[model samples]
Target: MTDAPTLHFGVFEVAAPQVGGTFSWAHPRSRSADFLDPQHWIHIARVLEDSGFDFLFFAGGYGYPLVDGDLPEIAATKGINFSAIDPDYLIPVLAQHTDTLGFVVTLSTGLEHPAQLARRLASLDHLTSGRVGWNIVTGASQNAVADVFGQDAIVPHDTRYAMAAEYVELAARLWEHGWDDDARVVDRESGVYARRDGVRPVVFEGEHYRSRGYFGAPPSPQRTPVLFQAGTSPAGRAFAARNSECVFVQATTPARTAAAVADIRALAAERGRDPRGMKLMAGLTVFVGETEEEARRYEAEFDAMQTDEIVASLYAGNTGIDLLALDPDKTLHQVLGQGSVGEMGTSNIDRFLGENAPTVREILDQLKGRGTRGFRLVGDGTQVADGIERLAAETDLDGFLIEPVFEPADLEDFGRLVMPILRERGRLREGAPGNTLRARLTEQPGNDRLGDAHPVLAAD
Candidate 1:
């Protein structure tokens, strides 16, 4: 029999009261209201670490879904995607309590300067003991970005990727080349803290960004903190192939995901990168129970919390299309022909426009919870593991980023019910104490640093 493929696991979270489902906070079992308490996050980190999760991935950006320059009723009143605190501040505290778990925090290339962003990330690497990763994003919604950040003009879609390419290059240079590995001497007898010759300024000039000065910090472990990118558009895919160590994709279907996976690997090969070096993780949500019937019951309960009206409004803010105002029976093809989608999320829109174009009502039901987009499995522990194994095999995916339907309870259930089954099958990594986040995620034993093939290490 062929050996089972090893898969990494992570939790997809936002720093908010509710993440995956609308009104998920209303669930009797949910403790999402405790998000503000440091203990809440600390308990979560401990649970995940004990459960053998590879990392905690925080989804972030400044933009909320807006329609006609106003927040939708569900978004405004129910706090759907509205109460996000910056996960950056919360990481240090979580790091203090956990020993092996990694944290990947999202920061936009659109909002912060590359130099400052690099410094902050490097500091996080040090604080977390090299258990840090960065989810680099070009703002998904340009209108929302402009509204929230008070920008005078919107940067076009492709142009944002262009700027991100420049931004990432500069930041990587600072992380990889600014200071020599042995630069810090701390020679008390000689009164020389660092070797002056070992440190040098990283002078970079590009169309979108420029930097001239030595990086403010010395090298941390895994100097370039595992670079992660989540764009699946053409420009986004190209960017991921060139720069990302891990790529996050939201799966539309098994066949489509397989195609995307092949395309990304092919793109990497064309760029002179080892195709296997890039890890692709898809967003997946699992509803598990002791029996299949119980699992279905749980799924139905969550589904019942969604209302068509609220979901329709939330979809409008995400896609820049007011679907609620349209004919309920109109097909997505008809809707798309009516107007340009402009700068909102094309990825979400494309999901509905597939071969079997869904109607407005169908679209609303599918998007009942904003982040609940990918493959959703409802089953008992063994059955759920089988589904995950099959999905990974079919799609050539490296891992799954679990989107919790309810915060701590959902995670606890997965850990208690499903994790052991996978572990016994040798489908998950064994304990690797003292491993850097990169090493853990990539399953590269003892090597915490980026490989020689990475663009960041290429000679200028």
Candidate 2:
């Protein structure tokens, strides 16, 4: 009944202050809001569900943003951190409140064994009554490696993806092929409810990890939980195209977004997948009001609340460049060569800002365009919906990974005002929630495991 194409919208959990633009932590002075308070998140999630969101993603990492080798400036401003509230456990709390709101939790293949991660995610799926997703990440920063594994040697870029490939495959085996439909039944009469022959043991021994035998639990609603991928370097894109059901893309322009979507879809086609099956969700932030001028006024107010020094500090940590040490005029080309290359993709410093270093005043405004790797829409409800629709239509993106520009209120507006328009247009999911994250986002069959198009689906 709507004109918009089938797309599912999900909220991208912002770690601190402003949802879209980098804001302060819960308390800038004390930073003390407990990350596990389900009440706080429930307020956000309920708005999303009422406003028509398909899911809400809780994203985090083990370490802080160590981009350019500095944290003091970022820390003082209470900008984003390398550490986040452990969020997997929050799923049950969130599920206890809402029925259709799916949860996506980030865990990397580089850190743990497939058995442990698979069982954990499966348990979440079980506890959440089947509304859960697993975001597959390769370690983005070495800090996490040092912190989690107590090893300082970050794996090489290509090697990280290589290990991820193996990790994802092993997970598929444990979740998909390990059990049959009738593996568990707590019946008292026959005394034997489980069919032993039906539950198969998966034996995997690769260069990185090896697994022997069946998984610990019976299948959850979504066995492999929808696999979400977020990297887009050449190797990164390849990994996503092969294993990912949902792709989170960050970019600055609608044109760039269109190209990225086409690029990934082409890669999927080369792998013999129906390119349409891959859902490309781009980053976005919004400010809304009864009128356009009012929305503009709101953005200016939020921008005033932002501390540029703190923003730069986060930029420094994320890039590993020690921004304070260099004069703003110093070129990025020079700084990167001088051992400032301790981090991963600094798209803020690389693609958008493009110079090694620019003066604060001249560069700070420029930094806004690339923060989340997508266009940040600022306007009233109608205008905001107009822009989102434009981005989706022009770029051919499936939907958005919405970030809040002003914490709870920013999210509140999107759900209240913009979402209905999108839902009316068919730009957001118009259907009832599915049993699993995969089924909710995709129209394809609910496999409860990796589909045949995924590389992991063929490894056995």
Best TM-score among the predictions, by candidate number: 1
lDDT of 1: 0.83
Instruction: Give residue 345's error in model 1 in angstroms.
Output: 0.9
For each candidate in the order shown, give its overall lDDT on alpha carbons: 0.83, 0.71
Model 1 Cα lDDT, one tens digit per residue, 299-397: 888888878766765566556677777787977676664444645566777767767788888877667754445789989999999999999999999
Could you give me the TM-score of model 2 versus the true structure? 0.90
* TM-score, per-candidate, Cα-based: 0.95, 0.90
Q: What TM-score does candidate 1 reach? A: 0.95
| Candidate 2 lDDT score relative to the true structure | 0.71
Q: In the order shown, what is each candidate's alpha-carbon RMSD?
A: 1.9, 3.2
Candidate 2 — worst ten consecutive residues by lDDT sum?
Answer: 24-33
